[model samples]
Target: MARKPGLLMAQLLNRFIWFDAALQKSLDIRGHGGVRRLESMCMVYVHAGIRRPSELARLLGVTRQSVNTALRELEAKGLVYLEPDPEDARCKLVHFAPEGAVMREEALDIVMALEAALEENLGRKAVDDLARLVSADWGEAPVIGKKGVGKAKERKKKSA
Candidate 1:
């Protein structure tokens, strides 16, 4: 018997969803003050120096509107603030407020602890390998009407 083409991807996605849910619950219990998962992710990107709303949306693979909504929530919670970008008059940059900086540190510490737990569960070597695999460049994305579709048609013809 053969495994499905998307089996690995499906499994990884399912695990990530469950892991994110657990992480959210853990953060809530640790007094993170009811932040949503998207808000937390946006903060991480801001901490990583992605300041522009458009850039954050691109990095998170979400729409700019969604990022803006998350930013608004974070701002309401006193976790983030938006300031006019000096270089670009039309855009605003996202920044951590004083409280948000502290929250960012706590979030990072929690993430590190989770990584350590993963290492313990999967072994250091396996965890390292998985990290390497995930971080490696997989080349450009495939386009539906381009080479990918043509290749699929060719494969189908060959099989038929």
Candidate 2:
């Protein structure tokens, strides 16, 4: 059965939540303790070089305060630390601690295992094609104006 495009994102989110649950279970067994979705997301963004809290909030569609709170919890877990941004001392940047890096590597291994399991059920080509399609640049998201007109928003630079 063909799926509706509008529901695709929701389906993707559901899949991600399933992955998150599996990840948390594995981490817990490995003594990483309970890691919230937001904290794990923060780690992924920071690992990808998005360090500023404001930027993380924007990407996550949450408030800066929320991002800060999650960061604080992560710090308490000894997974990450907030350091002064050299470019702007007034702002703090997120960086993974030594232990955090190790943890991330372990999580990545888990992800690989999950992907392998998916392949076992869905075939290797299907999994590879899904990854390629999602990773491809699909251009900008649409901006809907009043009267139901829609237009693509220009791509913005990832500057901090």
Candidate 3:
């Protein structure tokens, strides 16, 4: 098949990068210094109640080591602290540092402003529909073999 312009995955990734850059730029204007995308995402996940680095790795689809590294960076920035997990001695739980509260709250407010700006540009309904579609569970990937992708192509050929 010929390549198509504006594929769904590309569009989604482009929008993601756009928002990520926008957030970073807004943070910079507030004199918060530069924050990497992964680091910022880690903060967001931590605020959402994902305490363990292992769970954060799972949610981010990254390795546990990556999550640990990001957490360490956050610790260095005084944005978060990691403590020994009470339930599991081998694990550590993430928490926002006392000094980090102001920055965290400011980042959240920036996100809300970004969303409001999106709604202004795209309309509230469009933004709501985008959120709903992106959040909806689409299930697992196809097996893609003798009975999967090949069969799909065969059906497509017949329809054509």
Q: 1-160 in candidate 2: lDDT tens per residue? A: 7998799989999988988888899988997767899998888788789999999999899999999999999999889999999999899998888867778888989988999999998999999999999889977666664534342222222331
lDDT of 3 at 129: 99
Q: List the residue pairs that clash in candidate 1.
A: none
Tens-digit per-residue lDDT, 1-160, candidate 1? 6787869889788877766776777778878768887887887788788999999999889999999999999999998999999999999999989976766777778778888998999899998998999889977654454565467666667999
TM-score of candidate 1 to 2 decimals: 0.82
**Lowest lDDT 10-mer window, candidate 1?**
141-150
Q: Cα RMSD (Å) between model 3 and the true structure?
A: 6.2
Error of 3 at 66 (Å): 1.5
Choose the strongest candidate by TM-score: 2
TM-score of each candidate structure, all chains considered together: 0.82, 0.85, 0.83
RMSD of every prediction: 5.3, 4.9, 6.2
Clashes, model 3: 0
lDDT of 1 at 100: 68
lDDT of 2: 0.87
Ranking by TM-score: 2, 3, 1
Q: Scored by CA lDDT, what does every candidate get?
A: 0.84, 0.87, 0.87
Give the residue spans of candidate 3 off by over 4 A: 1-6, 141-143, 149-160
Between candidates 1 and 3, name the one with more favorable TM-score.
Answer: 3
